[model samples]
Target chain A: MPHDHHDHDHPAHSPPQPDDKVHSYYQILGVALKELLIEKGIVTADEVRSAIEKRDQITPAHGAAVVARAWSDAGFRTRLLTDANAAVAELGYPMTTTRLVAVENTADVHNVVVCTLCSCYPRELLGLPPAWYKSRAYRARIVHEPRAVLAEFGTQLLEETEVRVHDSTADMRFLVVPRRPAGTESLDEAALAELVSRDSMIGVAVVRQP
Target chain B: MRGPHDVGGLDDGPIDPAPHELGFWEKQIDGLRGVIGAKVIVTTHENRRYVESLGDDAYETLTYYERWTAALSRQMVDKGLLTQAEIDARVRVVRERLAASGELAPGAEDVKP
Candidate 1:
């Protein structure tokens, strides 16, 4: 007889408790599975830890700093607009094979990025993704109704401002270099970086004068 | 199959301005994912493919790290790096220990891996 013991009458596990605080079955499973992988020597705990540390190194501030420099130095902005990967590397931000694309927002144009396939962002530069970026609602709606979504984010574009939404469907990740607000001609690069919020880099909002 | 994860241009709701605090296990899973990919065991494409094959409900309901780990387990088993029996044993032990300690619901003791 063929060894069919694999399907032995093991009972089903009930779904997670409705206690609301209980970890989901999948979450618990993840913990156990990760342990097994580590035990088997397929990967080291230090490797995973280093990967996490690398992610923690980047923040919205890194992306903001780049945007700030672009604001103060037209040359950098032009280079960023032309070759974002090189421009970001010039700033000593970690570089990988994934291409970085910086889209500039001008008076007549507003750009927003949404990945329809997955929640891919400029992770190497902006660190981890936000909850909303991974939410089904945001992913499904942003591509079609970017204007409405931006409004929800409290970003209202001028009627004349063209809403250009970029669907990051390829290997390229996008960073929106929002237009500098007026009355900020005196602000230096460091001060300008402080004004660049995470959402602004994501293109859901614009950089405003403090 | 057109997975729910491919949702784009579909209407939803407002973004919660609140920040998300990653749970302990989430951090581990995400890091493990990076290490796994760095090892070239599974590419992002393969991971996405596994995620999409998890059926629409699991894909939609599972948290980001949950899906990543699930797909990872799937790939590890597929690649012969680990066995389902070993994984099931560990999962069962974890559930029992937690359930016994009241960390998990008491009824979870009867759960089959």
Candidate 2:
């Protein structure tokens, strides 16, 4: 009875809201002091730096390659749509944490991803998510009004593409593998990578012709 | 302390908290610190008068920060900056150094107990 009363009183006396500013990305990704010391023993600072650089260079290209292949190869597209993890690995970007879910932006429903629980991004393929992608405004609004959220990012989907909001919970994360843009029929893998921004993969932006 | 996930509709604005560019693990640590700080101050203030009504239990209830600091020290150790032995040694040294200097209050060292 006492515990129940405590729980009841909790909601009635919650504090006023806090600030809306997001934490800085560098502060977010910086190694803990302990980890930094441990890392010095295990690997050189230069080595760690090089590893990060290589990871950054490869993942976006790898993701674009998958998108390009998916555009051309029917079987690969099927595999990507059906099993995003295996498809991503097939293209050589094997992400350990994120569970890849390709939300097809079609004439019907367009899928957008937001981690209401935490920032569960597809870093293995897309690299780091953009600053706005992780903002409190984006996280809270995307779920309720996907179209308006997308509009803020300068992405105006056709009215036909019904906005389907996907929230990343504790266990699983999602990525939106947007429908390949039209007129990109002739572009190569390298060219395609230029068009695939991190925001696009989150379903907030779309690849447009240059 | 507020949970990282509890920042929605904050500051009377509709904007979402921008995601910091840090990697997942780093963000978790920051979130942990925020949560702990929020919990301690809120709890202490909320129960201050209640503790005055029940002296010993109130003191016991106010030991939240001690538990959190201990957990944070353990986390630092687990992350590999310090060994368990080092943390224990550091805690002992800090206690002794403080006590020898008369910095320890009448019951401060007994907070953990």
Query: Model 1, A127-208: lDDT tens per residue?
Result: 8878777677677888888888888899887788899888774367999999898988899999999999989988998887
Give the TM-score of each candidate.
Answer: 0.88, 0.57
| Model 2: how far residue B78 lies from native, Å | 7.4
lDDT of 2 by residue, A1-210 (tens): 012312122221122113222122112112233244334363344444444565456445566677777777889889988988888888777755446777777667778888653355676676655555555566667777777777767778788767887876434557676677778878776676677766667777777775
Q: Could you tell me the fnat of model 2?
A: 0.11
Best by TM-score: 1
Docking class of 2: incorrect
DockQ of each: 0.44, 0.09
* Candidate achieving the largest DockQ: 1
Question: Clashes in candidate 2: how many?
Answer: 18
Candidate 2 lDDT over residue span B2-81, tens digit each: 44344333432244424444443334443344333333422322232232233333222222222233345444455564
Which segments of model 1 are wrong by more than 4 Å?
A1-22, B100-102, B105-113
